[model samples]
Target: MKKNLLMLFTLFIALFTITSVKADDKPVKNNYRIASDSLFAPFEFQNSEKKYVGIDVDLLNAIAKTEKFNISMDFVGFQTAVDQTQAGHADGMIAGMSITDERKNVFDFSDPYFTANATIAVKKGTKNITSYKSLKDKTVGVKNGTASQEFITKNKDKYGYKVKVFDAADTMYASLGTGSIDAFMDDEPVVKYAILQGQKFETPIKPEKIGEYGFAVKKGTNPELISMFNAGLAKIKANGKYDKIVAKYMGNEASDDKKVDESTMIGIIKNNWEQLASGLGYTIALTLISFVLALIVGIIFGLFSVSPSKFLRGFTKVYVDLVRGVPLMVLAIFIFYGIPNLIESITGHTSPLNDFAAGVIALTLNASAYIAEIVRGGVNSVPTGQMEASRSLGVSYVKTMQRVILPQAVKITIPSLVNQFIISLKDTTIISAIGLIELLQTGKIIVARNFQSFKVYGLIAIIYLIVILALTIFARRLERNMK
Candidate 1:
């Protein structure tokens, strides 16, 4: 009986030891956040269902699956993706990003998954642009932060062409269509995809292999992720999945579906109402939330401007001046991209602000500055005697200011506040620079897919006009009520 008990005890110890070792040896599971370009078609783009589908999307997802890893993808724009990865907000990026020497300094790239050439595309049937020399005296367009832009800018002196940099490919393509730019340089596959989708453009110049596309992580970070990507990519390629994904997007078979006439305003709205509504919702939400927060903060600062303490007043003045002095777009970028980078560098910790939070903070700061001035102006407009009378009647300073001064100041500031709200609403469009899909960005996306810039932009303008008009009427009614 004693021998049997000892044997059972030994068996139990062996099982426990084996379990502990296996647990320690097992790889930790992590869901990595990956970023990619929002509108690079055939590489990444929204389908009719509003779902993102493309070669890059499929390829990355396949690799993740094959490697038994998890990932969440953010379809931010190319420049924004690079910013996010550098800021450590994203674990990696696979946005058809070119692996270049300059980029190598900042990013550790996986093995090249695809190679693409930069090509000069001119409006169709334009026989003049046969070579780089033929581009002399022509205005050439390139998307911001692209290898094509780098190449074009470097050779612009020799080519004798003026360079126009667009923040997005949609605008660049639109410029080419409207003849604002004589030609544009873009990835060959992107240009081909655009042509396939009915873009009236032709590449006359021979394409130059700028660089091969690779999955990248920030240097000295996520080395394991790079290894996993390389391994999975090889597996996919070996098993023929890579070729299948490539063929799915870049197949020789042209689409046979009839093109809808989205040129008409009504047609454009009909086709894009879902996206428009989603965008409008975000715009309104951002505007309302930011304005409310700004109002609260601005009122406090405005009171500071009129405070008994000279220091408080001076602080308020400086803050208002500082924020108001900066452009809204710049503020958005700084908050969204710059702040994260700053935080990481100083603390060695990654802190990334999402688009919504960053946009609200930027808009609030900007609007608060103006709102503070309005409040100051309103408070000053009130009679000084009222404050004295309230204080003489045994009211404390806070009570007197709240009951006597602020009530009247609010009435005086109503119109200005309403105007500021309208401005803030319009300003939300600028927040799209940071990749928030507000109304204007939505319109840009639609224009990219359909190439109907005029109709889409016109509709967006009309929507803004209607909303502003309604707000103006509401403000008038509110003023009358207060009177």
Candidate 2:
């Protein structure tokens, strides 16, 4: 009887173990991912320790805890973060962005996360231009590829001012601090936050309503995720977490009523936008001029490198190596500032060329180096046997390259050549460092006077994306043809 009872107990234990193993075979849950660009300040910005930490991050962390969903965060450029979400590489994105009607057609967005009035920041007590109207004919800076660019570009004729554009707000603001820009536009709350954090700039330039910031996800994504996010956002707002985050960043002006000074802010917007609009013409012109120069220089240098003469080949090779070795920014500065100084010293006269010419010269010279490589690679791609065959047929060397080797080489290099065109297109921004008016420089002047970071940058981003996308498509087609 004891042996039978022992056997029964062992059988019961084995059955329970089998049941538990079956339950464990169910699928495990995964945390969702979100992407953001660390640009919007207070809401988002890189901390002193050089880590991305902001109200946006803090809020998201709180939401994750409450929602009980795994949350992963990744940093990319704001627009790029949107692309990742659209591509399903990320579950969502939340930087301080506006929910413009145009964007609504493409992506799902959360309700307005926060509101900020646009205001301008300028040096403490500089006078020639107090407001946007006064900015006429004065050099102004803006960050390229933002709503500010579009607004200024559309209204320059109406405003009668000149604008310069730069690629980044940090760079644009840097120029303003150095007095390179008269003023810039930005969100009032954000600018105030920057000022509290140690930015030295003149008081209230004026204020303008640019737009509000919103969170975004890919259009037609898992609605459940968006639902959960919206719910969590509501939870935070009701529990006072949102106000607490805002108050923590409010500095001494923690009082709820410190509105962005309107009159001063508006004046700055008028100045910066007027300047930005005036610069649109020159921006397009620079791209055309630099592109033409890059093409001519690229083709000539490429042919020289392909020449049979060791002297021609050696000279072109050195030129390509030297230019390609230097960064585009360094070359732009040298051409714009260094060359003119050298010329003045030798001739005892300042540069006779206009600012535009200096810019064109710098950008093209740098571009030619890469163009030369692209051109040379194309010429060399033709099998050596083809050149030998042409020579055997008694064709002149130049004729053989032009008719037989060159044609085939060009086909192979078309893609890189187009890329060179795009690079030259962007290289125009580098001209701003030398004080030349272009798309990017225009952005800085506007930002200086108006702190509409989202509205301003959103304008420039769309313009550049359009141009870059077109060039990319062209390159793709060219590659297909060659293949």
Candidate 3:
């Protein structure tokens, strides 16, 4: 009986030791936040179901599972992802980012998972260049911060050509198609994908300059995360999962044999209706909020501009001049991206505002400046005799301005106010530069996915035209009634 008890106790101790060892060996399984681009197709992009699913996305998810870590992916734009990651706001990023020596200073990279090659292409029927000499005096388009851009800049003197950089692939392609550029360089896979989708570009040169893509993290941070990614990538490659992912997106071969449909425009609308509708709804919401806010701000500043106190008038003038001096796009960037950095520097705490709120703030400040001028002009347009006559009738200065001046000024400014509203409505597109996904940004996303720039953009333009036309007619009717 003593031997039996001793044996049982030994077994329990051995089991506990084994369990503790296994637990220690396992990863902590903490959640990590990753950022990626929204429109980098086959690598990372939103599908028709509005879900992000592509090569980078799938690979990261598989790695997360294998490494026993949780992940949250943010499909922001490429620049935003890079900025956030460098700012320590994100754990890591994988946006088809090409590894380069310059980037190595700021980001540590995992093993190269993708080897991309680039080719030069031009619009169909354009002259094809066979040698560097043939590219003399030509302008080529390249995406900003891309390997192709670096290549072009390196060889521009040799080729005697000028380079124009574009922010998005679609924009570069558009510039080429529109004849603004003689030729453009892009990754072979992307150009092939665009060709498969019926984009009218012809590859005239052999592929050159291979680029290696790797997952990245801020320099000197997240070493464990990098190790997990490398290990998981190796495992996937060994297990055939990597090949399967590549085949799923790129297919076994690049082919332009897909049928082009006559009803493609209708099909695009049918497929992207939800995106368009949501974008339009947001546009309208932003416009209304901005206009109302601007109206209030304009009135307050307008009163200040015409106040009896010279200091108030001078203060209002300075504010108006400062705000109006900046372009809407510049203001949007300052409000969205700049302010957070400023606050972070001052307080050592990051305070980031959502894109929508920042956009509204920018538009309000911009519109307020114009509206203040409109209001001041309207008030001045009102006769000085009216104010004097009201004052002689025992009305206080405030009462005279409120009862006599404002009412007439509002009436006089109605047409101009409506026009300003129209201008504000159009200016909402500027917010897209900061990634608001307004109507224009939504259209760009759809174009990125479908490679149907003309169809999608034409649809968006039509929608805008119709809305503006209706507003113009309504404004005309309102003006006639006032008359």
Say which candidate scores most in lDDT: 1
TM-scores for candidates 1 onward, in order: 0.90, 0.49, 0.88
- RMSD in Å for candidate 2, one decimal? 19.2
Residue 223, candidate 3: alpha-carbon lDDT:
77
lDDT of 1 by residue, 397-428 (tens): 88888889999999999999999999999999
State the displacement of the C-alpha of residue 307, model 1, in Å, after optimal TM-score superposition.
1.9
Model 3 per-residue lDDT tens digits across residues 92-140? 9999899999999999999999998899988877765766678889999
Model 3 regions more than 4 Å off: 1-31, 48-50, 87-90, 124-127, 220-224, 253-263
Tell me how far the alpha carbon of residue 436 in candidate 2 is from the true structure, in angstroms, after superposition. Answer: 29
Q: Distance from true position, residue 20, model 2, in Å? A: 31
Displacement of the residue 159 alpha carbon in candidate 3, Å: 0.6
Instruction: Give the clash count for each candidate.
Output: 0, 57, 0
Q: What are the RMSD figures for all models against the true structure?
A: 6.1, 19.2, 5.5
**What lDDT, from 0 to 1, does candidate 2 have?**
0.68
Cα displacement (angstroms), candidate 1, residue 168, comes to: 0.9
Off by over 4 Å in 2: 1-29, 145-155, 253-483
lDDT of each: 0.89, 0.68, 0.84
